[model samples]
Target: MSVLMSAFATLVGGLADLLQPLFHAGSAAAAIILFTACVRLAVHPLSRAAARGQKARTKLAPQIAELRKKHGKDPERMQKALMELHAKENVSPLAGCLPSLAQIPAFFLMYHLFSSREIGGEPNELLGHSLFAAPLGHRWADALTGDGVFTGAGLVYVALFAIVAAVATFSFRMTKRQMAAAPTPAAPEGPDGRPLPGMGAMAKVMPLMSFGTLLTVAVVPLAAGLYMVTSTTWAAVERYFLYREMWAAGAAPKASGAARGAGGAEAA
Candidate 1:
């Protein structure tokens, strides 16, 4: 984790190094949007895979439960059974974990980019000027100390920060809800098909961390901050739609009550 974090920080350092020239062209917003687009595109495949894994789990929920009922205490047997089952169904149990893991690198990259204070040998010109003098659209984070801590704020900066904050927060809540679909299942099976406390356990904690972090965006330069929040919000929107489709696929038979009928309950 530390190595990946540092590598992303290094990415921030590199992007800040080369793209400083675009600041002069008054395209900081464009630059930010472009960078974010590239990052999202890079992670899209993993996101789709995770969605696939999630759908697979939903599709095979009954078999997963039966397997656990039979071998809940034997880790080895559980893993073998899961592998066999997944192979038969062509599903990757860990698929849902991919998108989250992929985002860590991009999240930290944005943090480094936003925390950066200088571009090239020149003082940073986020939207083409000094920190306080830069437009609200440009100053995403306040001017950071050499130690990389944000230092100040203004009315314009605060207002814009709030906008991004709201978008990031709402999108996150909506996406997670869409992914888990119905109330989160308790004791969700893990990748090895072993029964474990379900995602509901973490769901209770993540929202607090998410909202708390979103609230802190007011400390950054406006442009850098918006890039982070906006990209994340866009990713959430994209992910939710993806999950919605996955949900539809998994719950298809249920829509016709076939999933619940006694006549074919065993088949369902």
Candidate 2:
């Protein structure tokens, strides 16, 4: 863990050194943003794959619904049919999760890289840096409690909070739009053909994840907060462009013959 964090901090410090001319001492914050952008770009191929997979699943949702209708009574058979359908379409249930899963390690590394007082077994000088008036190493809690809420440093934290909130709002809207477009899962139905209990509730709650993100920003070191804001904002915009490009080009997978045959047989 120490070796990996040492390497990670080295990379960030190197980037900070590179950008020092432009930002002066504030370059540490800018470096975190740039490093995050590089990470985002590096993981983009996985993001593209995940996007393609999600779009394919959306395209195949109807056939999946049919399979569920046919095999609804037997959980084992339904699972088997679902797997067969996915195999035919060349999709994985986990495809949409690939980029996110891939990013977890790096994300935690950045968090620790900024949050720690030591790196490479030495006192971390990077923490001495500040962005605007806010110290990169200072948590929002520290700024509020120590500096008082109206002080310059405390206000800097507030401004960061605001930026994060705005990004979170935009993210929430985009997520809600996508969820609205998603075909409802082919699960057991409740009265009046309604979706089963908790489905609607789950949909409503998912958008609030953005607020959860805001909560994270409120406690983390300013450097990590900067990372969160930059990465999430990048993710929202990246997903938008990728989804449009893939959809405009008609890249979503079409149902294979086996899936169509199964659905047709059930229909008849």
Candidate 3:
């Protein structure tokens, strides 16, 4: 583990050196952002695969709904049928999670790198870096206690908060729009066709999950906060484009089906 930490520290230091000319004192902070972008790029293929899997699931909704209806009285049977269907269709139930899960290690590395005072028995020089007036090793609480939110480090945190809010809002809207357009068929329904028990409440709360990043950025070291912001922003933009492509692709089939139905009606 120490070996890996040492290597990651080396990578970030190299990036900081490369960015020093452009970012000056904040080069290390800039390096964190660049490193995050590289990580995202590496996991992009998994993201694309996840997108395809989501499209497949959307297409399978009707079949899944039928399975649910057929086995509604037996929860275990319904689950087994659902699993079988996904396997038969070559779609993974957890595919959408791949990109996010793949990023956890990188974020953890950044957090520990900045949080540590020593790395491999030597002083950790990266902790001395700052993003503008904010120390990369410091948290928002430290900024608050020192400068009280209107000066220097506090102002840097305020800026970070504002950017996070804007990005989170955008992500929230995008997710809500996607949910409306292609809702999951997995929401259990009671006999009267109402959403069963807590399902409706769960649906309502899911979109707001994006804003949870604000709390994360507030508590973690600034270096990790930078990673969170860059990653969340990238995810929002990537989801928008990918879902748009899915919608376009889905539309073509529906249009052809409609045309075929009209032709049959005229012939009849």
> Over the stretch 175-230, how does candidate 2's per-residue lDDT look in tens digits?
76566555655343332233567776676787878777678778877888888888
Candidate 3 per-residue C-alpha lDDT over 156-249 given as tens digits, one digit per residue, 9 for 90 to 100: 9888899899999998887776665564643644433334788877778889999999999999999999999999988888888888866566
**lDDT-superior candidate, 1 or 2:** 2
Which candidate comes out best when scored by lDDT? 3
Model 3 residue runs over 4 Å out of place are 74-77, 186-200, 246-268
lDDT comparing candidate 3 with the true structure: 0.87
- Model 3 clashing-pair count: 0
For 92-193, candidate 1 gives per-residue lDDT tens digits of 867777766776666555555445554343444443423334453333343332213333435545455566667667766665555456333554556566
Q: Sort by TM-score, best first: what order? A: 3, 2, 1
Off by over 4 Å in 2: 186-200, 244-268
Give the CA lDDT, 0 to 100, for residue 26 in model 3: 94
Clashing pairs for model 2 are: none
Ranking by lDDT: 3, 2, 1
Candidate 2 RMSD computed on C-alpha atoms after optimal superposition onto the true structure = 8.0
In lDDT terms, how accurate is model 2? 0.78
Which candidate number has the best TM-score? 3
Report the lDDT of model 3 for residue 206: 82
Query: Of the candidates numbered 2 and 3, which has the greater TM-score value?
Result: 3
Question: Candidate 2 or 3, higher lDDT?
Answer: 3
